[model samples]
Target: MIQLKSLQRVNPRDVEAPKKFYVQAVGAGKTDLDRLAYLISNQSTVRKPDCYAVLEALLHNMMDELREGRIIELGNIGNFQIGVSSDAVDTEEEVTSNLVRKAKISFRPAKALRDLLQTVNYKKVS
Candidate 1:
């Protein structure tokens, strides 16, 4: 069994602030830092210059691909494809119809994230 240090043993300040911000400002409903701290200390969070910047870039790329009517597949994760509704379809059946015009983006979690979630063990609830 792997031994892991509790959040209290690590940078308590950094850990506490974000948890509070998420709960109070973001309205996360409840502030729970135990799991977040575990993942952070274990280096599970994706490393980048800034999380928002990375997300912005990812969204931009996904939107660009969607607009071009192309599916974007993230490794280990799922693919994003633009969706079409029956209401949007034309009555006349036409071969090679350029009906898929609107852009949409979807997300699928990676296998690593899924596996990690499945294997995560929490401390006994008091």
Candidate 2:
């Protein structure tokens, strides 16, 4: 089950304004890749080792493609791409690799994944 937690965060700028109450995810209740392969092996003819190897290869290839400035799309899964944030430059000539403050991998969830999220049952952590 999806687990949630409530937390109070103090506002450093205005202590008199009172702390804000926020709800966050405590756990998604996930299984690791090896465990996932084992579970898949139980339902299919493929052995766990084969399933794990395939998963590892898929990851390696996906990373390689992403590094080559290509968006990786897993059908009915999501699209993954690289994103960057940079410091503001006064002119185009001032823009350079050094200006890049951070790089991030972004994922745009597919419609099917969004639908799955809607169906999950959540309970607050006690």
TM-scores for every candidate against the unseen true structure: 0.39, 0.89
Question: Model 2 clash tally?
Answer: 0
Given candidate 2, what's the lDDT at residue 95?
A: 87
lDDT of 2 at 99: 90
Instruction: Tell me the lDDT of candidate 1.
Output: 0.55
Clashing residue pairs in candidate 2 (N, C-alpha, C atoms within 3 angstroms): none
| Top-scoring candidate (lDDT) | 2
What is candidate 2's CA lDDT for residue 64? 100
Q: What is the C-alpha lDDT of each candidate?
A: 0.55, 0.91
lDDT of 1 at 18: 38
lDDT of 1 by residue, 1-126 (tens): 222333323346665553321111122244334444444546746543344455567878878988898988888876778766333645566523465555345566677767877775444211
lDDT tens digits by residue: candidate 2, 94-113: 88999989999999999999
Error of 1 at 106 (Å): 4.9
The reply for model 1, stretches above 4 Å from the true place, is 1-49, 88-126
